[model samples]
Target: MESTLQIMPVQRTSRNFGEYAEEAVIIEEPIIKQKRPLFIEANTIEASLEHLRNDCIIPVFAKDNEATLSHVAFIEVVQDAT
Candidate 1:
């Protein structure tokens, strides 16, 4: 199994000059799919994301298990200003 989670760094503007700031990471974990730590160990998170994007099939608890949906979701990356 593979997870479709992506932990990206959050970028923010410093109150100061032209310098850029990087805060905490924001994860965009897949809503329709989940994987365990073993899967993460088998492949890096990045590899897992790529594989999930291509080969993973998302299960649908909706439609009384009679249907499946192509789940592609994203979330905004944010962090504390401080």
Candidate 2:
């Protein structure tokens, strides 16, 4: 008898959860804006495309280490868009 195995993919949620609201004047008007920070990572460009869709982040800056493995970290700018 033979058995079959099924492989599943990872589901990602929205990592961005930071925003900024502002009011210029008291009796004039109000303004609101949101800051969106994003980080995209993967082994190859093909896989990175999938990460972009899942994480909503574009690979702006990148660094390839020849002696270390890749990793991720959260920032204090707008959100943990990674």
Candidate 3:
């Protein structure tokens, strides 16, 4: 006597949770504008010092609204003096 085995395919189903359904709703928040420190670059020491001068505006190169890393020097301005 010969015996044959039968195979069956299983179906997948997604489980729903109450917490996941609550998290699906997104709440929009108001955006607040804040002042951020900007770093400037210069070639020489004199040029770097020039950038540190108050009320001095320097040209900066950026791509896609972001600063690039190819600058020659970097300067950070401190608001509070100790």
* Best candidate (score: TM-score): 3
Q: What is candidate 1's lDDT per residue for 1-82, written digit by digit as tens?
A: 9979899999996687435666769999778765556865778555344566578777767758764544333211222232
- Pairs with backbone N, CA or C atoms under 3 Å apart (clashes), candidate 2: none
Q: Assess every candidate by TM-score.
A: 0.23, 0.17, 0.25
lDDT (Cα, tens digit) per residue for candidate 3, span 1-82: 9999989888998786765665457899999987764444333244455444544554546655554432233333232322
Candidate 2 residue runs with Cα over 4 Å from true position = 20-82
lDDT score for candidate 3 against the true structure: 0.52
lDDT for each residue of candidate 2 in 52-75, tens digit (9 for 90 to 100): 446654334346433322222222
Better of 2 and 3 by lDDT: 3
Q: Point out the worst 10-residue segment of candidate 1 by lDDT.
A: 73-82
The 10-residue segment with the lowest total lDDT in model 2: 68-77
Order by lDDT, highest first: 1, 3, 2
Residue 8 local lDDT, model 2: 97
Best by lDDT: 1
